[model samples]
Target: MNVFQSLVSSWQFWAVLSALAAALTAVFAKLGVKGVPPDVATFVRTIVILVFVSSLLFVSGQFSIVRSLSRRSVGFLVLSGLATGASWICYFRALDLGKAGQVASIDKMSVVLVAIIAFLFLNERLSMLATLGVLLISAGAILVAVAD
Candidate 1:
């Protein structure tokens, strides 16, 4: 299979890619927020993301699906967008005020919260091993946050 097809077929590949991108995001955002207000930085970043993603949607013909989306779907998507904007604003502020490593470690704790929320609200089930893994991740994040 082609490299594109191989990547599309592998969840591990996407996860690793996302991790690398997130690492770069922290580093780049730390630099970008220097001397700039976090809110402004977030706004600029959001504009860039909107342009890039809109371009992707147009190029991939996904824009056609927008007209068919239900109002509920659009509302949920708007809510998600607002949440993402809030997250970026807070993340930029944290990076501006603290070391990126510490801030990112604390941010990683969201994974633990997401798992718990999914289990409770979405009726998602976690096996014993998965629960242990989440606990370990939480501990590691805490250790990183508290470390000198």
Candidate 2:
């Protein structure tokens, strides 16, 4: 099977797992900034992820995943990691400066950005309903941010 079919067929096995992972990420971040500075808390978070992932690699005998990455791939991985770190920093800073509802609402606007980027750069097409949905998401995000 192609990767997409493989994923769809196995999705019932992974859906809850993915949802739980998302929940843990949100909860941990909400709790993380409670006492710690957002930047340092973000650092602690990266360290925790590294520890957990490295342990999983060791325990699962998947060291080949770590070892097989080529130097160019390693550079791309590092760049992606840095970008994620920067996003986390900005996300927490937004939450630290504003309400969680507002920050999350604004963050969800990334969906619209991704859709537009895909359309522009990849020549992807959106249906009329999809275009309307993007506009609605953007409008809702603006209201969420501006609402008192």
Query: Clashes per prediction?
Result: 0, 0
Best by TM-score: 1
lDDT of 1 by residue, 13-116 (tens): 98999999999999999999999999999999999998999999999999999899999999999999988988999999999999888999999898999999
- For model 1, the local distance difference test gives 0.94
For residues 3-101, write the lDDT of model 2, one tens digit per residue: 888877796759768757755665667767876788988888889988999899899999888778899999989998988888899987876777776
Off by over 4 Å in 1: 1-4
- Give the whole-model CA lDDT for all candidates, comma-separated: 0.94, 0.83
- Per-candidate TM-scores read 0.94, 0.74
User: Which consecutive 10 residues in model 2 have the weakest lDDT in total?
Assistant: 19-28
Report the C-alpha displacement of residue 60, candidate 1, in angstroms: 1.3
So what's the TM-score on candidate 2? 0.74
